[model samples]
Target: MAKNLIQVIIAGGRVVGQAFTRALKQEYEASQRAAQRAGGGNQGRKSAANDTFTGMSLQEAKEILNVSDITDAEAIQKSYDHLFGVNEKSKGGSFYLQSKVVRAKERLDIELQSHSKQKRTDQPPDT
Candidate 1:
Protein backbone atom coordinates (compact mmCIF):
# COMPACT_ATOMS: atom_id res chain seq x y z
CA MET A 1 0.00 0.00 0.00
CA ALA A 2 2.82 2.41 0.88
CA LYS A 3 4.58 1.49 -2.31
CA ASN A 4 1.41 2.17 -4.29
CA LEU A 5 1.00 5.56 -2.61
CA ILE A 6 4.62 6.46 -3.36
CA GLN A 7 4.18 5.47 -6.98
CA VAL A 8 1.02 7.58 -7.29
CA ILE A 9 2.72 10.65 -5.78
CA ILE A 10 5.65 10.22 -8.17
CA ALA A 11 3.31 9.88 -11.11
CA GLY A 12 1.47 13.06 -10.18
CA GLY A 13 4.85 14.85 -10.49
CA ARG A 14 5.15 18.61 -9.90
CA VAL A 15 1.50 19.49 -10.39
CA VAL A 16 0.13 17.50 -7.46
CA GLY A 17 2.94 18.58 -5.16
CA GLN A 18 2.41 22.21 -6.11
CA ALA A 19 -1.32 21.95 -5.51
CA PHE A 20 -0.74 20.50 -2.07
CA THR A 21 1.78 23.22 -1.27
CA ARG A 22 -0.62 25.94 -2.38
CA ALA A 23 -3.42 24.54 -0.24
CA LEU A 24 -1.14 24.41 2.80
CA LYS A 25 -0.06 28.01 2.21
CA GLN A 26 -3.63 29.18 1.93
CA GLU A 27 -4.56 27.45 5.18
CA TYR A 28 -1.56 29.01 6.91
CA GLU A 29 -2.58 32.47 5.73
CA ALA A 30 -6.13 32.03 6.94
CA SER A 31 -4.92 30.94 10.36
CA GLN A 32 -2.61 33.91 10.56
CA ARG A 33 -5.46 36.30 9.79
CA ALA A 34 -7.61 34.70 12.44
CA ALA A 35 -4.81 34.99 14.95
CA GLN A 36 -4.33 38.64 14.12
CA ARG A 37 -8.02 39.28 14.61
CA ALA A 38 -7.73 37.68 18.01
CA GLY A 39 -4.85 40.01 18.89
CA GLY A 40 -2.39 37.17 19.15
CA GLY A 41 -0.37 37.99 16.06
CA ASN A 42 2.85 39.90 15.51
CA GLN A 43 1.36 42.11 12.79
CA GLY A 44 0.39 44.78 15.32
CA ARG A 45 3.53 44.46 17.40
CA LYS A 46 6.04 47.29 17.00
CA SER A 47 9.74 47.11 17.63
CA ALA A 48 11.29 49.62 20.06
CA ALA A 49 12.86 51.81 17.38
CA ASN A 50 9.86 51.64 15.07
CA ASP A 51 7.76 53.57 17.61
CA THR A 52 9.83 56.74 17.07
CA PHE A 53 8.49 58.27 13.85
CA THR A 54 6.91 55.77 11.55
CA GLY A 55 3.52 56.36 13.18
CA MET A 56 3.90 53.22 15.21
CA SER A 57 2.42 53.08 18.71
CA LEU A 58 4.57 55.00 21.20
CA GLN A 59 3.76 52.60 23.99
CA GLU A 60 5.10 49.70 22.00
CA ALA A 61 8.28 51.55 21.11
CA LYS A 62 8.85 52.61 24.72
CA GLU A 63 8.48 49.03 25.79
CA ILE A 64 10.98 47.97 23.19
CA LEU A 65 13.37 50.72 24.25
CA ASN A 66 12.97 49.60 27.87
CA VAL A 67 12.65 53.21 28.90
CA SER A 68 8.97 53.81 29.15
CA ASP A 69 9.45 55.71 32.41
CA ILE A 70 12.04 58.11 31.07
CA THR A 71 10.86 61.02 28.91
CA ASP A 72 13.74 63.49 29.18
CA ALA A 73 15.42 64.57 25.95
CA GLU A 74 18.90 63.72 27.21
CA ALA A 75 17.76 60.28 28.32
CA ILE A 76 16.12 59.59 24.99
CA GLN A 77 19.28 60.70 23.21
CA LYS A 78 21.38 58.40 25.32
CA SER A 79 19.08 55.50 24.62
CA TYR A 80 19.19 56.18 20.91
CA ASP A 81 22.98 56.25 20.95
CA HIS A 82 23.13 52.97 22.83
CA LEU A 83 20.67 51.23 20.52
CA PHE A 84 22.48 52.55 17.44
CA GLY A 85 25.81 51.35 18.74
CA VAL A 86 24.44 47.85 19.33
CA ASN A 87 22.89 47.70 15.89
CA GLU A 88 26.03 49.06 14.19
CA LYS A 89 27.63 45.63 14.05
CA SER A 90 27.07 44.19 10.60
CA LYS A 91 26.47 40.49 10.89
CA GLY A 92 25.97 40.32 7.12
CA GLY A 93 27.42 43.70 6.10
CA SER A 94 23.90 45.12 5.85
CA PHE A 95 23.28 48.76 6.78
CA TYR A 96 19.70 48.20 7.94
CA LEU A 97 20.54 49.12 11.53
CA GLN A 98 22.19 52.40 10.58
CA SER A 99 19.26 53.29 8.36
CA LYS A 100 16.82 52.56 11.14
CA VAL A 101 18.84 54.72 13.55
CA VAL A 102 18.82 57.61 11.09
CA ARG A 103 15.09 57.33 10.62
CA ALA A 104 14.46 57.15 14.38
CA LYS A 105 16.56 60.28 14.96
CA GLU A 106 14.71 62.14 12.24
CA ARG A 107 11.39 61.21 13.73
CA LEU A 108 12.42 62.16 17.24
CA ASP A 109 13.77 65.49 16.02
CA ILE A 110 10.57 66.27 14.15
CA GLU A 111 8.45 65.40 17.15
CA LEU A 112 10.59 67.53 19.46
CA GLN A 113 10.46 70.48 17.09
CA SER A 114 6.69 70.29 16.78
CA HIS A 115 6.34 70.00 20.55
CA SER A 116 8.51 73.06 21.15
CA LYS A 117 6.56 75.01 18.57
CA GLN A 118 3.33 74.10 20.26
CA LYS A 119 4.68 75.17 23.62
CA ARG A 120 5.78 78.53 22.19
CA THR A 121 2.45 79.09 20.50
CA ASP A 122 0.57 78.41 23.72
CA GLN A 123 2.42 81.19 25.55
CA PRO A 124 0.89 84.69 25.75
CA PRO A 125 2.47 87.06 23.29
CA ASP A 126 4.35 90.08 24.62
CA THR A 127 2.20 93.21 24.74
Candidate 2:
Protein backbone atom coordinates (compact mmCIF):
# COMPACT_ATOMS: atom_id res chain seq x y z
CA MET A 1 0.00 0.00 0.00
CA ALA A 2 1.03 3.65 -0.39
CA LYS A 3 1.83 6.04 2.52
CA ASN A 4 -0.88 8.40 1.30
CA LEU A 5 -3.54 5.76 1.83
CA ILE A 6 -5.21 6.38 5.20
CA GLN A 7 -7.36 3.83 6.97
CA VAL A 8 -10.44 5.49 8.50
CA ILE A 9 -12.40 3.38 10.90
CA ILE A 10 -16.10 2.87 10.21
CA ALA A 11 -18.49 4.55 12.65
CA GLY A 12 -22.05 5.70 13.06
CA GLY A 13 -21.73 9.25 11.64
CA ARG A 14 -18.71 10.04 13.79
CA VAL A 15 -15.04 10.54 13.03
CA VAL A 16 -13.09 8.97 15.85
CA GLY A 17 -9.67 10.16 17.01
CA GLN A 18 -7.79 10.70 13.78
CA ALA A 19 -5.07 12.82 12.18
CA PHE A 20 -5.80 14.66 8.91
CA THR A 21 -2.80 16.97 8.91
CA ARG A 22 -1.60 15.65 5.58
CA ALA A 23 -4.99 16.12 3.91
CA LEU A 24 -5.37 19.68 5.17
CA LYS A 25 -1.83 20.64 4.17
CA GLN A 26 -2.36 19.19 0.69
CA GLU A 27 -5.63 21.12 0.33
CA TYR A 28 -3.98 24.38 1.38
CA GLU A 29 -1.14 23.90 -1.07
CA ALA A 30 -3.54 23.03 -3.89
CA SER A 31 -5.58 26.21 -3.23
CA GLN A 32 -2.45 28.35 -3.15
CA ARG A 33 -1.23 26.92 -6.45
CA ALA A 34 -4.64 27.54 -8.04
CA ALA A 35 -4.66 31.12 -6.79
CA GLN A 36 -1.19 31.75 -8.23
CA ARG A 37 -2.25 30.45 -11.65
CA ALA A 38 -5.34 32.74 -11.64
CA GLY A 39 -3.23 35.98 -11.81
CA GLY A 40 -4.04 37.00 -8.20
CA GLY A 41 -5.86 40.14 -9.38
CA ASN A 42 -8.68 40.63 -6.92
CA GLN A 43 -8.90 44.41 -7.25
CA GLY A 44 -11.26 45.01 -10.17
CA ARG A 45 -13.56 42.07 -9.61
CA LYS A 46 -17.22 43.02 -10.24
CA SER A 47 -19.74 41.64 -7.77
CA ALA A 48 -22.30 39.04 -8.78
CA ALA A 49 -25.98 39.96 -9.11
CA ASN A 50 -26.74 38.04 -5.91
CA ASP A 51 -23.85 39.36 -3.85
CA THR A 52 -24.87 42.43 -1.77
CA PHE A 53 -27.42 45.27 -1.78
CA THR A 54 -26.42 48.72 -3.07
CA GLY A 55 -24.49 48.82 0.19
CA MET A 56 -24.82 45.13 0.97
CA SER A 57 -25.24 44.04 -2.68
CA LEU A 58 -28.34 43.66 -4.85
CA GLN A 59 -28.35 39.91 -4.32
CA GLU A 60 -28.32 40.13 -0.54
CA ALA A 61 -31.06 42.73 -0.43
CA LYS A 62 -33.20 40.62 -2.72
CA GLU A 63 -32.64 37.58 -0.58
CA ILE A 64 -33.48 39.53 2.57
CA LEU A 65 -36.79 40.64 1.08
CA ASN A 66 -37.38 37.23 -0.52
CA VAL A 67 -37.55 39.03 -3.86
CA SER A 68 -36.18 37.55 -7.06
CA ASP A 69 -37.34 40.11 -9.62
CA ILE A 70 -35.11 43.12 -9.33
CA THR A 71 -37.09 45.44 -11.60
CA ASP A 72 -40.46 44.82 -9.96
CA ALA A 73 -41.09 47.49 -7.35
CA GLU A 74 -44.45 46.00 -6.39
CA ALA A 75 -42.97 42.61 -5.65
CA ILE A 76 -40.08 44.08 -3.70
CA GLN A 77 -42.43 46.28 -1.65
CA LYS A 78 -44.71 43.35 -0.91
CA SER A 79 -41.85 41.17 0.23
CA TYR A 80 -40.42 43.92 2.38
CA ASP A 81 -43.80 44.57 3.97
CA HIS A 82 -44.33 40.90 4.74
CA LEU A 83 -40.91 40.58 6.35
CA PHE A 84 -41.15 43.87 8.20
CA GLY A 85 -44.61 42.97 9.44
CA VAL A 86 -43.40 39.66 10.80
CA ASN A 87 -40.47 41.35 12.53
CA GLU A 88 -42.27 44.31 14.08
CA LYS A 89 -41.20 44.91 17.66
CA SER A 90 -44.82 45.05 18.84
CA LYS A 91 -45.38 41.66 17.24
CA GLY A 92 -42.48 40.02 19.06
CA GLY A 93 -39.88 40.97 16.47
CA SER A 94 -36.20 41.75 16.68
CA PHE A 95 -35.05 45.29 16.10
CA TYR A 96 -32.12 43.96 14.13
CA LEU A 97 -34.39 42.08 11.71
CA GLN A 98 -36.66 45.10 11.22
CA SER A 99 -33.67 47.29 10.52
CA LYS A 100 -32.34 44.81 8.03
CA VAL A 101 -35.67 44.78 6.25
CA VAL A 102 -35.68 48.56 6.06
CA ARG A 103 -32.18 48.67 4.67
CA ALA A 104 -33.00 46.06 2.07
CA LYS A 105 -36.01 48.06 0.90
CA GLU A 106 -33.94 51.22 0.65
CA ARG A 107 -31.21 49.47 -1.30
CA LEU A 108 -33.68 47.98 -3.77
CA ASP A 109 -35.29 51.37 -4.32
CA ILE A 110 -31.94 52.94 -5.04
CA GLU A 111 -30.97 50.15 -7.37
CA LEU A 112 -34.19 50.56 -9.30
CA GLN A 113 -33.68 54.29 -9.68
CA SER A 114 -30.12 53.81 -10.85
CA HIS A 115 -31.18 51.16 -13.33
CA SER A 116 -33.93 53.38 -14.68
CA LYS A 117 -31.56 56.31 -15.09
CA GLN A 118 -29.02 54.14 -16.79
CA LYS A 119 -31.60 52.98 -19.29
CA ARG A 120 -32.65 56.54 -19.99
CA THR A 121 -29.06 57.64 -20.54
CA ASP A 122 -28.42 54.73 -22.88
CA GLN A 123 -31.26 55.67 -25.20
CA PRO A 124 -30.47 58.00 -28.12
CA PRO A 125 -31.87 61.52 -27.75
CA ASP A 126 -34.67 62.61 -30.08
CA THR A 127 -33.09 63.33 -33.44
Best by TM-score: 2
Top candidate on lDDT is: 2
Each prediction's whole-model lDDT (CA): 0.59, 0.69
Stretches of candidate 1 off by over 4 Å are 1-66, 69-71, 90-94
Question: What lDDT score goes with residue 9 in model 1?
Answer: 82
Q: Give the per-residue lDDT digits (tens) of candidate 2, residues 36-115.
A: 44334441122322123245666678889998888999999889889989999999999999998998898778778766
lDDT of 1 at 30: 70
Give the runs in model 2 whose Cα sits over 4 Å from its true position: 1-55
**Which pairs clash inside model 1?**
none
TM-score of every candidate relative to the true structure: 0.43, 0.56
C-alpha lDDT of residue 31 in model 1: 59
